[model samples]
Target: MRHRHQAAPQQAPWPHRVKRQHCRGLADEADVPPAISQDWRSFRAALVAGSRQARGGEQSESNQTLLHLQDPVLGREAVWAHSIPDAEQGGLLLATRQAPEVLMNDGLEQAVVFLASHGPEGSLGLLLNK
Candidate 1:
């Protein structure tokens, strides 16, 4: 006696794909530049001063802070400057800005440099190594 084989059931076609509707109200929010704008030199000076203040026992009201600097080469000059607790012994600590690409890759490109002490403070970095 020969046995008959049964065919497998087929799946129905997927429903017509519909594009998602996204809200545009939030997307229209314009980027407002900082009130005080300055050249690279002036910007760097401000950053250094702020770091010094924090180092000189000046406690920031808000533990978390976002410092914005306006300069021509923001992509290059802007960095998360930090001051070691000890000025003379610890010395100035400079962390090179890291970009998104650097963070995803190994040290193949420039490594995403960050301050070792940027703890509790919550830090985000950008790559400055062009």
Candidate 2:
């Protein structure tokens, strides 16, 4: 009896290598969900509005900036202990990026002073008074 050699199995092509046509009409087709389309439209509108607002100076600090603080230490004892400058005693001071100043209370307890920036949803603050 003669022995017959079997052919090797063919390998499948990679999915990444498959060619696809641009579905230009798919965007207009009613097959797309209404909610998905609405979401896309809203996203596009927001992007455009943001770009326009940015260009129109609506995002400037004078227009969009606000200050916030928590647990403020005030009065003569707090001031003397912290060694805060006389001029800045009762005023809000902008926090420096470098080493933040340490603030102390009459009880000799220490706290960090901070300047806060607030937005519509949230706020960020830097400790400047401690």
Candidate 3:
């Protein structure tokens, strides 16, 4: 007589990465569990908290990562938009006039770029709607 073979235990998938893949249109939610979703939310909150700390005095009650720049011309409320540090791969980058430096040599004012890569190594994106 021979013994039956046993399968190894399955490992849990990373909810954060899975959610990103979903946003990138690379994965479906059908296979995800509810617990994973909750875990993702917790993880996101932690990240947002860290972002707030990283920005030093800026604070936001909402989950959106925002940056407010003072108007140089009119000297009024200038621009309020998502911070560049929040950019991710496969995400869209909207060039803002308040940006510290010119985004591109061709002029990124009111331009959009597709983020191909984003990380500590730096970023690379494709210009769009030129």
Candidate 4:
């Protein structure tokens, strides 16, 4: 059966509980697709052999541009860990691409979010689907 519903957690946080439901048959730490299940021994061997992929600029490079919020609430926004957002700590996060006049449909984008933590800057959470 498809695990589309959140399962009872064995000490999981609320968000992870939700993710567990979302990634159901697609992926998991110990669960592999049925097609690959039969050849897992070979798969494991190949994975070990090809591990530590060849390093290069293309493989090591990544970039991120912070999106700003227009009408951010005070003290509740997710800020990039390296900098302080105008929201301070608890405001809403808005992506630069989101148009203020656009009618958001079914939380289709990461245009808005709340900062759930302060130190170590945990995950960037968007309560769209939920």
For this target, which candidate reaches the highest TM-score against the unseen true structure?
3
What local distance difference test score does each model get? Answer: 0.43, 0.41, 0.61, 0.46
List the candidate 3 regions with Cα displacement exceeding 4 Å: 1-31, 34-85, 104-106
Question: Which residue runs does candidate 2 get wrong by more than 4 Å?
Answer: 1-36, 57-130
On lDDT, who's better, 2 or 4? 4
Model 1 alpha-carbon drift over 4 Å, by segment: 1-31, 34-48, 57-130
Clashes of each: 5, 10, 0, 7
Tens digit of lDDT per residue, candidate 4, span 1-130? Answer: 5485967657746443355756646667457677568766566445544542433112211232222233335225532232222443444555544544464563535466675543455545545433
State the TM-score for model 3. Answer: 0.35
lDDT of 3 by residue, 55-92 (tens): 78463434222222333344344233334467888778
Question: For candidate 3, what is the total of clashing residue pairs?
Answer: 0
> Which residue pairs of candidate 2 clash?
101-130, 102-130, 103-130, 111-130, 112-130, 113-127, 113-128, 113-129, 113-130, 114-128
Better of 1 and 4 by lDDT: 4
Rank candidates, lDDT, best first: 3, 4, 1, 2
Error of 2 at 111 (Å): 65
| Per-residue lDDT of model 1, residues 19-86, tens digit only | 43464433222332343232544565577777787667444434233222333345344344444443
